[model samples]
Target: MHGFIGEFFGTMILILLGCGSCASNSLKKTYGQNSGWLFICLSWGMAVTMGVYVAGMLGSLGHLNPAVTIPFAIFGLFPWSQVVPYVLGQFLGGFLGAVLVIIQFYPHFKESKSEEEGNSVGIFATRPAIANPVFNFISEVVATFAFVYILLNLGNFTTGLKPFIVGMLIMVVGTCLGTTTGFALNPARDWAPRFAYTIIPVPNKSVAEWGYAWVPMLGPIVGGLIACGLYTIA
Candidate 1:
């Protein structure tokens, strides 16, 4: 129960800050409007760092992402018994965080032209820059594999430095690989918010692109599992 609460709020904070950054950059009439990819990537990195810190404080493993949780469990780093609870917390937290984003940028949602331009969905979920599922899936798998692999090896770091380093890793990955499919390396991060976009009535919202949703969701899970396999072999 304690772990569930921590994971829930930790993932919530992750999306709150991460998606909040995207909304600020994409939505009109915001201070961060048009800030470009660099700013968004940096903010998301910090979001991960903050979420980890908060989860750690609550005595949770701080696996705000299911990609992280699954790999850890498969590698025996996390208990298999707790995986369901952690994932459920993550998905719920992500949905709630996206809801918060809608509320935070209510005026923009009502007034912004992005919705009409068919670009409003990007704020809530990742979209491919090139729109090729095969390549996009590959990108997500590779990116998430690297992310989970690096994370599993970082267990030796002191608590204070671990989150910071992890944040840097995310920032680097986003800067380097995000353009391909916006680097939706965490399934919970992508799917939950996308689900929210489908249910919530944002003015002139797109169709939620359900066709491509499976790429981000399945790719990350597969990648995380592969990382666990490799880690075990090592």
Candidate 2:
């Protein structure tokens, strides 16, 4: 239960700050409007750092992403028994966080004429820059492989500094690889808020672009598993 709650709140905070940054950048009439990719990437990195801090205090490993959780469990770094609870917590938290972003930017959402004009759905989920599923999937796979691999090996860092290092890893990955598919390296980060976007009625919001959703979900899982296998071999 402690793990569940910790994961839940930690993931909630992650999405709250991460997606909140997206909203501020994409939505109209905001201070961070048009802030660009650098701003969003930095915000997401800080979100992960803070979420880890929050979850660590509650005795959780802060696998706020299922891609992270599943790989860790498979590699014996996390208990298999807790996988379901952690994933559930993450998904639920992600959904709620997206809701919070909608509420925070309510006026901007209302004012937008359409998704093309507002890019509202992009605030909630990722879209490929080039609309190529095959390449997009590859991008996610490579990015997530790097993410999980680096994360699993982060123990070399001092305990007190692991979270900050992880944050830097995310920032670097986002800056380097995010353009292709928005670097949706975590399944929970991409999917849960996407599910929320389907239900939440933001004015002129686009259809949730379900066709491209599987790339983010499947690519990350495959990448994580590959990372786990390689880590085990090494």
Candidate 3:
């Protein structure tokens, strides 16, 4: 129960701040309206840092991402029994956070009138800069492989200062590999929030881009599995 609670709230905060940063930039007439990619990456890094801190302080290892939880469980680093609860919490938290983001920027949603004008699903989920499915999947796979592989080395990263280190790692990944697919390294981060956008009635909303959703969801999980598989060997 403690682990579940930690994951729930931790993921909630993570998505709240991370997606909030996107809304800030994507929405019209916002103070952060053209802050650029570095700004978003920096904010997302800090968002994960803060969320991990919160999750650690509460309980659990701060596995707010299914990419982390599922792979760790496969390697016996995490209890298999807890996998369902942790994943549920992560997905649910992400949905709530995205809902909050919608409410947070209601006026902006009303103002942005079309997909071409910043009302696209890219604000809530990822889209490939170049629309090739095969390459996009490869991008997500490689990016998540690097992230989870390094994360595997930092055992129990929820410990003090380590969360910050993880944050820096995320920032670097975003700056480097994330350029192609926006680095949707976690399934929960992309899928749940994308679902929220699809269902929720955000004014002047664009397509959910469900067609590309599989790339972020399946790609991260596969990458994490590969990372754990190699880690066990090495």
Best model number under lDDT: 3
User: By TM-score, who's the top model here?
Assistant: 3
Once superposed on the true structure, which residue ranges of model 1 sit more than 4 Å away at CA? 114-119, 156-158
Candidate 1 Cα deviation (angstroms), residue 12 = 0.5
231 in model 1: Cα distance from truth in Å? 1.4
Overall lDDT per candidate, in order of appearance: 0.85, 0.87, 0.91
- The regions of model 3 sitting more than 4 angstroms off are none
Q: What residue pairs are clashing in model 2?
A: none
* Tens-digit per-residue lDDT, 42-124, candidate 2: 99999999888888777678888888888778888779999998999889989998989888888888777676656557898
Looking at model 1, residue 66 earns an lDDT score of 85
Per-candidate RMSD, Å = 1.6, 1.5, 0.9
Give per-residue CA lDDT, model 1, range 1-234, as digits (tens): 767887888889999999999988887778888899999899999988888887787768888888878877877878999999889999999999999998898887766756653247788788899988899999999988888888878883228789889888889989998889998889899999999989988765667888888998888888888888898899
What does the lDDT come to for candidate 2? 0.87
Ranking by lDDT: 3, 2, 1
lDDT of 3 by residue, 117-215 (tens): 678788889999999999999999999999999999998989979999999999999999999999999999999889999999999998899999999
TM accuracy, model 2: 0.96
